[model samples]
Structures are given as structure tokens and as C-alpha cells.
Target: MTRRTVVADTRSFRSDIQGLRALAVGLVILAHAGFRTASGGFIGVDVFFVISGFLIIGLLLREAGESGRISILDFYARRARRVIPAATIVLVATAVASAYVLPLVRGAEVIKDSVWAAFFAANIRFSLVETDYFSQGEPPSPVQHYWSLSVEEQFYIVIPLLLLAVAVVVRRRAGEAAEADRVRVLRRTVFVVLAAVTLSSLAWSIHVTATSPTGAYFSTAARAWELGIGGLAATLVWGRAPRLGRWATEAVLAVGLALIAFATLRFDAQTAVPGSAALVPVLGSALMLAAGSTTGASSTYLFRLFSIAPARVVGDWSYSLYLWHFPVLRLCEEYWEEPRLSKPHLAVALVLIFALSAASYHLVEQPFRKGVRWRPRLRAITLYPVSLAMVVVTAVGAHAWVDGQIAALEDNPGIAVSDYGRDGLSKDPTVALVEASVLAAQDDRPVPGGLEPALGSVRESVAPLGDCDYRTGTRKLCAFGDPDAERTIALMGDSHARHWSPAIDAIGREHGYRVYVFVYSGCPAITFTRLTDGGRPWTECADFKEWALGQVRELHPDLVVLANNAYQSAAMKKRQVGALRDQLELLRPLAGKVAMIGDSPKLPKAPGTCISERDVDLGDCLQEPETGPTRIQGQFRQTVEDLGMTWVDARRWFCAEDRCPAVIGNVVPLRDREHVTVEYSTLLADPIAAALGIAEG
Candidate 1:
């Protein structure tokens, strides 16, 4: 097995390739830049994959034709030099910024991802962490775009070695036409892999669009097919294929650009992934690629347009722009405490990215890749380790910086969690908070007659009847069943109400029970009779109950329901305790057969914290709080014992012992921020309904 070296050569990067790069990167830039015309602009990444496959394979073909060997190490090392340095710069830079920007609970997760990206597992991490793209108001991670780099890296790892093995076989088998035969085998392999991956990706993409939209959008399994399409384009470079004619190419590029423009303007993450809609731009790109300027036809208008010197410059610097813009825009958003990008912000981002990508491409990528002043040894051995070191060092430094920032935030001259209520607002929003656990167990504070002091409403103590529900916003109420139907069971509470509603609704549909949800975002099932600790009437809460009472009086539902966390956050003060008692007393007989839905065991403050820190299998976030209300269980029992209501304790649903898994019944226990995601809620529908006696009815 004598080793042969393929002398690296320069086949001019066709104008069409440059134009395609311009198109792909432009789509991505416009979409990411919040350009309204390029909503589905991410399809550009698929185009980039095709362009990469074409370029890399073209290089491989050129080598095989010239020298009988494919140098796997040389190919990989070149890739390392070109992609690693700039990427590391972006990663390190973003990691540092992330420390100051993201919340501490989330900051550490981003730092962990930074390490994963440095190691080339970003695609996998994102697949697990960020499957949903439609969740509103979620923050962006600093290294979000690295998912594409992961795809490219994963491709490189497999393609080079496969190409090498194919080359080896051609070398041994082909007596005279080894070069041609070798290229054929490699081409076939690439085509086959692309075809397979394309099919799988398309299938997964379809599944995600319909089933799990979030996971479908982010996971590599659902996205790899786009890159495979590019790989298909790459395999076509060597054949004497009939060109699409200049007119066709131009029209396709124009159409592709148009489709992309329309998609950006018309579509959003809510529109779905890669379904029939994505084809408009992806195929359009393929057409422009086929209609090269080399074919002198009038149809090549867009090709010629993209081939122009300035457009090519934009294409050249696109990578850096893609990298720098997001970070700059994000950092600015964080600094200003704004969430969306503004026009001025976009202008700044574009300018910064242009400068950075230009400097990086010329000073770093070009200088390192082109050996005008350097040798193979210099390209492979000199630059690669330095780039790796920079990535690792920067990542660690950013982690430390983030740690310091969080510490600083804790000691800030301003506000903290205890300072504000559950909402990310400056004021409290609860009518009355009763810590049953503190009242029952801890000597720290008293219960219903001696609870803490936090008011619910800010203004208009006696608010209007219409704008009332157990929540924060204008439409603060989320109803589960018929808003106006007879034979009703009012499901009143927070997410627990949400969880129980589906089951109740299903049972309602089956057993002639109309379930009406008078649920707040996180507030529990207690009545609204007391003032907030701040001494304001809990108007919003009281209004919600009043509205329910009105509905009850009007329709004469068989039962009026109430449910809540009964979360006994320890250490209450005075009036809130008495208020709690009054609240329960007021609510106990809202219906002829009133019920209090008990709390499931609340997980501890954090995931995996109790086990790792407490050295016990206390379940995820679910801990037997030594100081607080006994989660949802004991509170329901207490309220029933005191107020004489039917107690429906759902505690048995989660607890098996002193240990209960955060997720029970093979479902995610909580969706996000404490409420169960729809999946788990749907799963637990039956038990909640039966427990509420709706199933028997």
C-alpha cells in the first residue's frame, strides 16, 4: 500500500459558484438581519452545502486527475485552518458577551454549549436543547448559528475518508483509466449518500412540521437533507452535462431570489419548516447554479448580476457578516434590555460584520490557505493548533466572565427575584399568597392569619367585570372548556388547571360535564378576598372569581371548581395568613360541592439539584421541602380540613415515596417555567378528570 500524494492545484472557482455563494449567504443574511423579504432565508444554508460539496469535490476530482492520490490529512488540515480560526473568534467573542447578557440560570447552559461547539457537537446539543422554534419571547443563544458549522464538520469527517477509500480502490482496480474510474466511484458514493440523507431529512422535516415543529426545525436529522442536496450538486461538477443555458440560469436565480424574498416577507417560524414552501428557493438556487455565465445566453441576467465585482465582494465577506452580525445585534439588545433588533442596530451589525469578515477572510483565511508565502507545513502544522488553543482558552475565559457577571448582578444596586414577584416586572401581582407550609410547619412565619404582605392590584381596586381573570395580561384568563355552557365544572387555578382541563374536557365531552377554566398563569385555586401584602385589593383575582361566580349564578353549573399550587413558599409575615384563611373561606362553597385540587410534589428549585447537592433521589426539582408548604398535597388537605370542602389531592400521581421523579407517567413533568407542556398535559388528562369526580359523573 504505497502512499501517493496528489499535488494540489487551483481550478478557478467558477463564477456560478461565486454567484451561488452570494445567493446563499445573502438569503441567510437577509433573513437573520430581520429583512422582511427573506423570511425563509435559512434555506441558504442548504444552498451553501451544495456549493461546498461542489467546491470540495471539485478539488478532490482535480487532485485525482492530476496525481493518483487523495491526501485525507491535507484536505482535513486545510479545512481546519480555514473554518476553525474565524469560527473560534466568533465563539470566544460570543461566549464573553453571553456572560454579561444572559440570565444566570440560562448563562451556564450557553457556556456548556460553547464547549460543545468548540468540540464539534453543537448540532447534537441544539437538537436536544432547542427543538421548538415557535415558542414566543425566548432568548437567542450566542452560538446559535454554529449548528450549520456542525453539519459541515460532520460531512467533512465522513466524505474525505470515503473519497480516500474510493481513490484507493480505483488505484488498485483501474489498469489505464484509474483517475476517471476513481472519480466515478467517489461521485456515485456521494450521490447515493446525498439521496439517502435527503429522503430521511425530508421525511423528518415533514414529521416535525406536523408533529413536533420545534424539534423538526432545529435537529440535524431533520435538516441534514438540505446539505445533502448541496452534496448532490457537488457530484455534478465533473460531468460534461448540458448547461441550463444562460437565460434559464438567470431566470432560476431570479426566481430563487424572488421566492426567498417572498418567503422572508410572508413566512415565519410559525409557517413551518421545509414543507412545500422551502422548495421555492432551494430549487431556484439549483437553477441559477446550472445557468453559468460561461453559457452566453440572455437568460443569465441574474448570474451576470451576481458575477459583478461588488456582489462577489459581498459574497466573499458573507461568512464573517453571518458570524458577527448576530452577536453584535444580540449584545446591543442585551445592553439596552430590548428583545428585538432595530434598524439602527441592524446598520451597526452590518457594518461591524463587514469589517470583521473582511479582516478575517483577508488577514486570516486567505493568508493561511494560499501558500504564496507559506508551505504545506506552515498551513497544516503552524496555524491549526493555535486556532484550537484560542477556542478552548476563549471558551473557559468566557465561562469565568459569565460567573463574575452573575455575581455582580446578584449584588446590583437595584432589584432581584425577591424584590419582584413571579412576573419580570417591578411590582407584585398577587392578591394574596398563602404559604401553608410555613403556617403548618416552619416557625418562620404564620399561615392564613399571619401570611406575608404582598398586594395584587396596582390601581382601580374595584376593577371592571369584563377584564378579570386569574392572570397578568389583558386576556389574563385561559379557559379550558366552554366559556358558556350548562352542567359546568369550573377548573380554576394555574397550570394545574391547564393540566386538569384536557382530561376534564375529554371526560366532559364523554360524561356531559362542561369544564370552564378560570385559570391564571401561575396563581393557585384560593379565593380572592384579601388585600395584597402591599395593601392593594387583589382586584384582578377578585374579579376573576366574581366573573366565575356570575357565570355560575347564570348557568347553574353542577359544580364550581378551584385548583392551585398551594405552593408554600416558606417565611410568611402577618396579614396574608389571615387573608389566606379568608380567601379559602370565601371560595369553599362557590359551588354546592366545592373541591380543592391538591398540589403535586413541587420539584426543588432546580433540575438535578436535590440529588447532586442533597445526596438523595428526591426526584428532579421535586423535594420534600423542609420549610415550605407540602407542595400541592398538604395544602389541599389543610384547606379541606379547615374550610369543609371535598379535597382532590393529586399528590399520589407523582409521589412513590420520599422520592418522586420530576417527570412521572412517562411524560415531561413540567413544560417550561413550571407549567406542563401540552404533551404531558394531554397524557395526564384521564387521571385528573377521574380524581375530580368528573369521570364518574
Candidate 2:
């Protein structure tokens, strides 16, 4: 009822926690800034999770202890005031900046990402997309960092209710017990619940990280344990400090800092994270908090060091810094068209990030969080829905504007569409015509008006291989073309091979042949021990390849088609060429004929994005062909040809006179930096069939 017990700050503020916040944000910034030593700096987010769990649950527990009940309204009001305002500003600002600075295709993506972030569902959006946070080729969404905040918000929503439920159940069970005993029982019950959650989530995190690393990285279920560990620590050291000696407390603090440092320096993009591996930083953070909660721990040198003026200042602004850095750095990279920012650009970006964080902290975060003196007490809580509505409106506006721009580009009179008569080098007239159109468009002409799979939707224009079983050793095929056709052909490889389905399906239908698809996203059909993006051995790929080959042998299809991106074979040492030859030899005995589609020319940028950004002079998006197939690709080609298997020279179809245009026959060739769009792949059917010497129906 009084000021002391009305709010949840029943415990005194710990400046060391502020220092930990500074540390967490620093690690994340350094990692994202491309500091090689801080490669594992992503663990900083795990540290933050631990800190949030400790602070939030501690607040809830303290309120229940002092006031005999928890005010869910007050808890949510504090969260809305402290979090929503600053987050909304970042979301809106990032959306506006993305529309102006990013390519039109990426702009659309950012808008969608912003909408998800506004609703506090950014993690869900990212998980659904299977966004590999560590991916080298794809640009991170501007709002990607919001995923961590989303996780925390979700935890906040549930933790209060959970604590309240525990308080209610304990009071009911202890109706005649003293107040002291009632509070004690409630805390103990909550501790058990937190422990159960921690262990179960940790187990799930390890399993999911192994099976589906990308999704696991963004999953709340996989990450809840980190926060639970923090909550458990808070519950253990709630009212009284740990009774350890000063020396013991200092030792705990030192070990905690060491663990954090080790993870920051030793971890890299290849580490499967927020799993068992994440325990280092999560536990380290919890230990640091727990150590400070010990008697006389605040006087320790480690605590004093963390509480220093500079560290505390940075920590105070840490939230704004985290929100602003990712979008600023990402957009800078997009502007410069460099995967890594140059020194000057990097320096400029740092300046801008700090300046913005400081301004937002003072002008937006502090003003709103502290509340206006004249405003009604409950008015601030309305910010939750208001901020969400503002962000959604911004996203909707951005989406419509992008669509309008694409439509306008499509209406340009200079654009050409001749119904794409097939004629050129391939026996298939359509393939030849498409190639000729591509070559003609190179170094000239604006993007054609009637671009297939309009630029706005091109990024999602991936071939549909959703029904195919990507992991199993068993033959689970997604059939295409005439299913009842007498003749049969099987397509097998990685995503690159999968993209060829549209074209393959067309060829199969024309020639009265049935098509069976067997493909996985990152798994190559090659027989080498492949490392996943996380640097772990990919045994599933090997298993699938073996089973697919065995099935091919049993069925002995009329034709077997194979292709894979060069990245799959990048890890092969001296055995790349040998591996291909061996794979070919195995296939020769099983299939009537074997053909390998050479990996497509690697584009410098995403074609849809390039076209969207340079529609006025589409020639700007033309790629000057590289020397030839990469070393791995060349080796695969030579071995396939040497083994007498048909090797399709795909470059001729995408490039001419050393110039490869982003679009051919009014079609965007690729959905992203790699992987052909289904529309363009469908156009390549005749060329592929001609190369394989397959007769027309």
C-alpha cells in the first residue's frame, strides 16, 4: 500500500547487473562488427537471458513476499513502459530506413520482419523461415536481433502468471499457516517448477540443435532453460545472501567471468548454439549474479570493477545499443555492397550506433519509462497496443509501397515480351530463345515489363519440394510430370538439383516420362563427410545419399539427374574429383544413363534484388562470368565427363560473351544469390533435355 511495497523493486538495485548488461551488449556488437576473436560473441544473448530471468523472477518473488500478492497489471504496465516505447521506435525507424536503403526485394522482407517483431513474434517468423543466424551468404534481416527481445517478452508474459499461480496454490494449501511459512512454501514450489522447466528445456535444446539447428537457435522452447537457470539462482538467494566467505564469493565471480570470456573468444559461427554449448555463458551469467547476491560479495574487487563509472554508463544504455547496432551495420553493408564493412565505414557505423543509442535512451526510453508527471497512472500501459498498431501500420504501408513500385516498373513501355519463341543453340527452341533473349538483354535494355514471378514475390519463388523427405535413407519421392508415364527419370542432388524440378517436369511431360524428385536443401549427394554450417559432421547427408543411390540401382531408372551447389563440395580436400568419379561409377551400373547439371553461375548479388534496385538500367545487374566453374565444380564436371556421363554446360544457358544477365526472357534467373527460381528453371527444360539427348514426345 505504501511506496516501498507498491512497486516490485523490493530488492536494492545491483550496479553489477548493469555492468553485466554492458558486457552482454558489447560481446554481441563485437561479434556482429566482424571481430574474429569475438566470433562466439553471440553467447552474449544467452547471458542476457540469464540476467532477465534473475531480475524479472526476483522482482515477482519480492513483490509476493512483501505485499502478500502479485499485481499482474502493475507487472505488465512496468514491462510495457520499459520495453515497448524504445522497441517501437527502433522497429519503425528500421522499417523506414530499410525501404530507402535496401533493395526492393529485401525491403519487402524487412517489412514482414518488422510486423513479426512488433507483435513480439519475431522468433517465430525466423524459425518458420529456417533462418540460419550464421549464414554467410544471406543478409540478416534488419529486425533479426529483435528475436532475442521476443524471447524475453514471451518469458515475461508467462513467468508472472506462473509465480501468481504458485502463490495462490501455496496459500490455499497453507490456509492456517503463518505468513512466513506461506511465503516459504510458495518460494519452494516455484523453485521446483523452475528446475523442471530448466532441465526439460535444456534437454530439448540439445536434441533440437542436433536435428534442426537453425530452428533450434530461435526456438523459445530450446532457450527457456537459460532463463530458468537464472530464476532458480534468484529463488535460491532471494532474501538472505549466500553465506559463503568473501574469498569463496570472489572465486565464484572470477570463474563466472572466465566462463563468459572463454565462450566469447572460443565460439564461432559453426557452434550449435543455445544448446548444451550455450550453458557456458548462461551458467556464467547466473554465477555472476549469484555471487553478487552473497554476503559481503559487493565489496569484492570484481564487483567494484563492474560497478565502475564507465561500465555502468554503457550498461545503462545497453538496450538501445543492442536494438540500433544490427540495423545500422546491416544497412551499411548493403550500401557498400560488401560482406564486411571497410575500416572507414565501420568506424562511421560505430559512431552512428552509439550516438543513436544515447539519443534514444535519453529522449525516448527514459522519458517514457519514468512516465510523464501529468499523465494518468495507468495511461502508459496502453503503449503496448498503441506501439504494436503503429508498427503494423508501418509494415503494411511499406509492403504496399513496394508492391506499387514493382507494378510501376512492370508498366514501363521500353520493356519487351515476344512470347519467348524457343530458338538458339539447344535443340529445344524454347531454351535457345530464352538464352538468346538473355544474351540480348545483357548490357542493354531495362528490366522487361512482364517479369515472371514479379520481383516482389520472387524471393519466395523457390521450387516446392516440401513433400519430399529430405533426411530419411528411405526412398520418399515427390513425383512430377505425367505420373503414369511408362518411361521414368529420377532427379537427385541438393537444393540446386531440386530447383531443376520445374524444367525437368516439363521435359518429362513432353517426352511422356515420369519424374521422381529426391533432394535436400544443404545436403549434397556426394559421398564425402560433409560439415554442416555449424561445422558439425553431417551424417544425415551421407545416409540419404547412400539410400538414394541404392534405390536408383534397384529401380534402374531410364535417366538419373544430379546437381549440387559448389558449397557442398567446398570441404573436399584432394578427393573431390575422385568422389565424383566414384559416385558416377556407382550410378553407371544402376541407370540407363546418368547426367549431371553443372552448378549454375554464381551471381554476385540476388537477381531479384538487383533487378528491383536497378530496374531503370537492368544492365547494372548483369554479372560478368567468373573464370569458369569453381575448382570443386570444375572437378565434378571433368570427372562426370570423364566417366562418360552427360555433363550439361549450364553456363552457356545463363551466360553469353562473358556476361550473365540477372533476367532472361523476362524471367528473374535466381530467387536469391543462389538457387534458381522455379519459373526460370522451368524454361531450362529443353536445354537440359537436349544435353541429355532425350527425345521429344
Candidate 3:
């Protein structure tokens, strides 16, 4: 193994370059911590990309003509020593901390992040993770910044080896011509990679801007061109420049610095394509490097600025600072339930980042880098597994614990469904698809208005003044719908069917009809069980629907009622109606009456909290409404109506004249993006009662 040492000519290295690194990384730190002024600070990463390209290319050129072997083991060993120690420490600690802090679903998400970080596949991870980037006012996980490191390291793995191979081939040919050919080959590779990367970035940026801008901002694919641009500079121009007059070089150097400063101040998160925006700093760095390496006077001013001692120190610590800042920011954000972070919080983040990075650099990074001083086998063997085990154990254990609770909730979806982020989302004013649909039902436009929200209802359907367990799959538990019960009525369906209950329950008490409801979460009162994942038959859903219908007939329900959102699609809606019809056909003979409460507006996409629901960041929802749900609702409505299901149209009911409020008349309409809030759902009681020919709830 060979150790690559800094040469005696190290003084020739520009100290201002390190300062430049400091400035870039500092911008990233501030930007991520939610400093509004640092909105353009994300361009710092682009600056770093250029710097990396310059430095790596310079290092490769230093050994370009050397005859001795380039040790792959040593190269990898240095990389591992520099990166794994601090990264693993953070990963292990963060994993354990997250197990306790995050909820079941969020905990699972963090574990996936941990696995990606451990393997240096964070770039790949970021590409797949669907989350907002600029609005990252939410707490980011510790592993989030690892994506940048992954890209650098992955590039390092290839670039050095490729350069080494080029050197070897050039030596075998043993001529200036052959060396030139070798350089050409290397340049060709760079050009090809750059072209591909740029094109891909352009395409992705356009797509994401049009479709999912937030995702595009965070995705590595959309950002790769920044790095590729630097790589192109390295291959095409870095070492081959001709000497220029000193004053001329200084002028060029000054211009470069001016460009970087200008870009730092002007570029921001919302800047689109960023293709040309990023070029300003990268090209600036290239010019500065060119001026210094050449005998040109144009670079003198820039070189002098980068040669300062303080600047060098900052550059030395820049990587460590970058690593430490995001976690500190995230901690504060999580603690505060922050949407917009305060300056004091950002300052605290900076303080924490500096303190930790300094401590970590001296204690962990320095010692490990001294490969000759330390016992390698001891450190590698003891540190590696312990660090890895910590991450794995913490992640897996936390996942298992969270999953167990989730599984329990899944098994008992009745009361447990209310526990799933309902309170958090409801208290927040953000509009999820469910909330949007609920509000849409209140619109002034003429909806085929039959149902309305029954506010201030305290009605219960369980009666004979006693409790009964109808939760069993096969057994039917009879509880009178009201203490003042007379004629029996039955309500049967999935959650959609269950939603009609609030009003029906009030109406049942008022009209002397005992409305007994048999309900399931997603397995609406439909007969079809074919809509399932994993290619498995859900015979249970089919049976539950069938048995509930049978019970309605045997119990001699006076008014047989069946209902669901008819908007599911003609084929799918027909299946749902067929199930409803089956129940109606059976009950009509026994009850001598039947009514199918119409379907509510359905959303196309599953409502997920687009923004943090707990923090109550309704600004984004109010600012840019999500259309996935409304579109799905249109499809669902068309399908259901096509099936000829007697349905109440909720489109006009939920919306205002044009804009629908997420919360209507002080009611939060959704638990998540899909399901209605129990409190909000209860509001529907009155409208249902009025439509059922009973007293207004």
C-alpha cells in the first residue's frame, strides 16, 4: 500500500480556494437551515462540484506520467478513512435517535435512509425519495446530505482508476503521440458522460417542473449536470492552458471572484433548469484555476485572495461543517414543528455544526487519516462492525416496534383508524384531498343536493341502551339503533357507507327506525374483493359484505339501505352497485322498502399530507392546490353514475362558489388525505337525516 502525501510545494496551493469552499458550504448550511437570505445558497453545492473537478483533475495530472503503480487499495483505504468514520458515527447515532422520535410510518422511512447511507447509495436514495426540496422547512434526516458525498465518492472510484489506466497505456506506447492519444481517450469519456448527464438533467428538470417540481429539486438526476460540467472543464482545459502575462491573469482571477459573489447573491431555490445559473460559479472557478496555473497576470488577484491562511483553514473544515449543519437544523425544526425557522434557531444550528465538526475532525478524521500511526487492523475490525451493527440494530429494532404497533392498528382498524395522524392533520389547516372533497360538498353550485352536514349532533346507533360486539367476522350482534327504537333499519358498506351514518343515526332516532350498521374500513359494503395487492384473493371482504346483507334480511330491517361513492368507474362502479343491488334484492322482499344512499365525491389519488400536517403549514396547500384527488373523484363519479347508482353529487356541496375551504364552518373534513375526520364526518349527520325523510339532524 502506498500513501499519497502532500508535496513540499503545498504552499503553492491557493488558500483563497479553501475560503471559497468555506463560503460555498456555509451557504448550503444556511440554506438548509431555512434562512430566507440563503435561498440561493443551494448553488453552493454547484460550486463544490467545480472545486472537486479542479482538485481531482489536478491530483490526477500530478501523477499522469509516473511509472510506479497506482494502488487501488490505498486509494480506497484513504477514502474509507476520511468518510466512513464520521459518517458511520452519525448514521448509528441518528438511527437510534430516530427510532424514538419518528412515528411508525416515518420511522420506516428513516430506516430505508439508513440503509442507503451505509452503502454510499444516497444519490440513488434521493433520486427515489419523493419529498419537497425548497420547502424542506421540515426536519431532514441526518442521512440526507450523504447523497452529495455518494456522488463525489462514486466519481472518485472511477476517475482515479481511469486516469491510472490511461497513464499505463500511455507508458506502454512510450511516445508523446501515444500520451496524446491516451489523453484523448480520457477526454472522450468525460465528454460522453457530460453530454449524457446534461441531457438527462434537462429532461428531468422539465418533467419535474411540470409534474413534481419539489421532487426535481431534490433528485440527484436533475442535479448531476452541475458535476458533469466541472468534469468537462477538468478534461478539456484544466492542465493544458498556455502561460499568460501576470497582470492579465490577475484581472481574469478578479472577474472569477466577482462572478462567484454575484451568483451567490442572486441564484435561488426556485431558479429553473439551473443549467446556466450554475455555470456562473463553475466557470468562475475554472477561470481562477486557469489564471493561477498559467504564468498569466489575470489570475494574480484571485490567487492572492485564495492564498490567505484563514481561508485555507475554513476550506480544511468545510466538509466537516457541511456534514454537521443539516442534522443540527433538523433537530431544531423537529423540536419546534417548524415551517418557517427563526434566525435564532439557524444561529443555533450554525453553532452546533461548528462545535461538532471541529470536535469530530480532530478526534475521528485526523486520527483515522494517520494510517501509519494507528493500528489499522484494530481500528478497522473494532470500529467497522460496531458502527454497522449500531445502525442495523437500531433501524431494524425501531422498524419492528413501530411495525408491530401498526400491525395491531391494521388488525383492529375500527377504533385504530382514528389514531392514524387524524388529530395531527385535523388540527392543521392544510388541505388534503379528503378535506378538499369534503369542502367541495358545501359549494353554492347546484349539486344534486340531498345530503348536508349535521353539525352539533350527539347521536349514537348502539342501543337497547346496551353494547354489542358486531366486530366478529361471522356473528351478528344486535344493538338497537336507539333507546326509543321501533322499526329496525340496516346500514351496510365500507367506510364510504359508514360515513352516511352520522345523519342516519340522528334520523333513525328521530324517525323511530333502528339503523344498525355493519362497517369495514376500505372493504366498503361492496361484494367485489378483487381490488387487492400481492395477487391474493380477499375472500374475507366478499364474505363480510355477503354476510352483512344476509343479516339485514334475517333481522327484517324495515328500511334496507346500501350506499358507496358511485364515482369509482363504470366497471368498478358496476361491481360495487351489483353488491349493493344484491343486498337490496334480498332486503326488498323482507323489509318492503330500500334506499341506496348515493356515493360521495371520490379523489383520484390517495390523499397524503403534501406538507407537514402537524406543523399546520396550510400555506402550500392554499398556494398550490393538488389536483390528483379531484381528478380521481371525477373518474370515480363518472364510473358510479354510469352504473346507474342513485347517488348524491358532492361536487358542488363541498366547494364554495369557486374556492373550497379545507376546513368548513370550523370542521376539519379529513383524518388524512382520504378518510374524513370522525368529528368532521359527524357533521354530515343532519343532511343525511333531512334527505332520509326524517327530522333534520
lDDT of 2 by residue, 1-697 (tens): 0011111222666888888889999999999999999999989899889988888888888887766678998887777777888899999999988987888899999999999999899999998877889877678998999999998888778889888888777767888888778778878898998898889999999887876788889989999999999889889888666678888989999999999999999989878887788999988998999988877777799999998988888888998999999999999998887789999999999999999999999988888766474144377678878998999888888888878877777765332334333333555454455456555565466676778888888988878765675653455666688889988899988888988988899998988888888787777666665675456667777777777777787778899998877753345645556766777787788888899998877776777888778334666777764443455678788888788779887867676666677777677788887678889898788767878899541
**Per-model CA lDDT versus the true structure:** 0.54, 0.80, 0.56
Score every model by TM-score: 0.59, 0.90, 0.57
Scored against the true structure, residue 326 in model 3 reaches a CA lDDT of 71
lDDT of 3 by residue, 336-418 (tens): 65655677866776777788888877787777777565446444445546656777777788777655543342221111113
How would the candidate models be sorted by lDDT, starting from the highest? 2, 3, 1
Estimate the TM-score for candidate 2. Answer: 0.90
Model 2 Cα shift for residue 112 (angstroms)? 1.2
Clashes of each: 34, 5, 44
Candidate 1 regions off by >4 Å?
A: 1-10, 65-68, 177-194, 239-245, 248-262, 275-277, 297-299, 371-388, 405-697
Sort the candidates on TM-score, descending order. Answer: 2, 1, 3
Clashes by residue pair, model 2:
422-429, 422-430, 423-429, 423-432, 423-433
